[model samples]
Structures are given as structure tokens and as C-alpha cells.
Target: MNPAVTPHQQIRATHDAETVRVYQAFSDEIADAALARGTFVSPPFKMERMTWIKPSFLWMMYRAGWGLKDEGQRRILAIDITREGFDWALTNSCPSHPGEAMGKEDWAKVKDASPVRIQWDPERDLFLQPMGYRTIQIGLGKDAVRRYVSQWIRRISEVTPLAHEIHNLVRQGRLLEAKEKLPVERPLS
Candidate 1:
């Protein structure tokens, strides 16, 4: 929403996932019915590999070009998953990049620890400009992905219209209005 040119740190919006929320981009072939039905399966969606979920809305939009670009990123879905499952992933997560202060020895251990990876990216405003705070993108691989598809997700919902609406608002210079309509997000659970 251009954030009224507000200070970036003050506007670091993040989703509050009490029940574990995730954002995924998919091709229309795989996403259409799955989004409508809130489920996933093979064929349309490859169920054999790892999957990543971005917890940030704008970030997902940025990665998928608001579903306007990319061969298999024409649709976007917001998924609600079990908190238990989400926590399991967190427990198994390893920092994609180790802390700067880590000892070389500790770094080596963390490097080999878990399949799930946690990363943070500069948060973005409605206009997709970088903000002061960071947002999360977690990668799930190997057994983690299998569990995610089979047990974690509680429901999935299509947020294409909302995404487009926000995108247009930003493109048209109506930042405040776009911010008003944005889904409330903050870190929780």
C-alpha cells in the first residue's frame, strides 16, 4: 500500500499463525480444484518431493508475480495446517544460514542437522518494495514433505482475487486502500 511512506520497521506486517498458515504457488492445473476442495494429490501436483511454504503474503506474490508470471505459478493458495504439524517442522528446522556468531564447530553440526530450512527475507510493502523487517520462507524436504501433504494441512483456500486486488491497488498508487483490505498478519505460534 506504499504504507503512506511510513517507516519500514513500523510496518513490518506478518501473519499470526496460531494454527500454522502457509502460502504456496501452483499451476492452475494443480491448484484450481485443490484450492476449491482444500486438498492435494498426485498428477496435477507432484507428491513425491519436498515443498516449501512462504508465510508472507506479499513475498509469495512477489515470487509468483501475483500469479501472472511463471509456467507453474499461475495460482496461489493459502493453507491452514495443524499447529502440531507445524511445530514438528519447526523442531526439525535448521537455519538455512547459520548465525554469524556460531563457532565453526557448531556450524558444522547445524549444517547437517535437519531437512527443513528456515530463511528470512526482507519484508515487502504493498508496492513490493523492501521493508525493514524480515519474513519467513520455510523449506520442507524428504520425509517432511510427505508428512506435510499427508498430515499437516487442515484446509486450503484460493486467495487469487484478493491477491490481484492488492496488486492492482499497488500498481494504481492506492496504497492506503490496499493496506486496509490486506489480511491481518503478525507472528504468533
Candidate 2:
């Protein structure tokens, strides 16, 4: 079993003791699996009074889950694994969002370059690069895609109810309705 599989789906797993225990168990399971698969373990995490763990990163890792990328450039192909899927990479690594590698100026360029499209380039065996953008390829397939989409569906399910309610309110588009819900203001001294 992939430790990347969420504890929520692990039916046998429980989190009654400590949040860290659940995270630790999950991380250990994933680390073992990653080692077995010969994937590169990320740089050791640094945190105060913490041993190789940080809550925010754990949350990000949880969100990313587990993924695989079959083909890519030297750096990307060296490992067939990722903590998340293609779209996650596209959106998160596209320079539009903050990530490990991309800086803000680069991200601004990508955002402004929006609707940047890609066409499969046989020579590259990957998506063609968008002009004025530095990223070349991004995607996942087979088991990785299926799992990532499944995780996406589950996450969307969890958030959709409240989102739908908000959408309905926005569709109504009434100032008075929004005004009623607005926080009361207090004068500052």
C-alpha cells in the first residue's frame, strides 16, 4: 500500500493519540515506500525543536500526496516520483504560484503570460515550452494520474458544499445581502 494514501482512506488508521503520530506514521510509511521505489528523498526538513518534521510542510505534503512522472528532462526523469500530480505541478510550479524553485518575479511573468499553451513536441517527448516562459514540461500518467484525480475528487467533495452556497449568494449579486453579513466596523483611536 502507498503510504501516500491518506489516513482518511486507510480505514484501519486512527488519529486519537497525537496529530504528530498520524503524520509521523504516514511519513514513515511513505519514506519506506519511496526508498523501496528508489526515489530521491527530499532534503531533510529543518525546524525548531522538531526532528525532521514541520506541520506546515506536512500539510503541504498531505495536500500533494504522492505521484509519479514517467518521462522528462534529466533532472525530472532521474526520479519517477513526486509528492503530487501534474496539474499540481503545472499550477504550483508554473511560476504563477510560490514553490521551492520559482521566485516571485518569475511567477509574475508566468501569471502575466496566462493562457500559456503547450503542444506536444516529439523532439522533447514532452509539452513544448510556452514563449516568454521558462518551464518546459509538466504532467503525470497511469497510476499517478488516477490517484491524483481521485484525491482531487475527494478534496473537492469536502469543499463544494460551502463553495456552492457562496456561489449561489454571489449569483444573486445583491449589495444588501452582502452588507448584512459584513463585519461591524469600529473606529480606531
Taking all chains together, each candidate's TM-score versus the true structure is 0.82, 0.20
Best by TM-score: 1
The top-ranked prediction according to lDDT is 1
The superposed Cα distance between candidate 1 and the true structure at residue 166, in angstroms, equals: 1.0
For candidate 2, what is the TM-score? 0.20
The regions of model 2 sitting more than 4 angstroms off are: 1-140, 146-157, 174-189
Kindly list the per-residue Cα lDDT of model 1 for residues 1-189, writing each as its tens digit.
344553333322333444666788998888976766667867677766668888778888888888888868878898887778777887898877768898777976975778788877877767677776667778887778878878887889888889989888888999889988777775453
Clashes of 1: 7
Off by over 4 Å in 1: 1-18, 98-112
Q: Whole-model lDDT, candidate 1?
A: 0.76
Residue 95 CA error for candidate 1 (Å)?
1.5
Reference-based TM-score, model 1: 0.82
Hey, what RMSD does candidate 2 come out at?
19.9
| C-alpha lDDT (0 to 100) for residue 32 of candidate 2 | 46
Which ten-residue region of model 2 has the weakest summed lDDT?
69-78
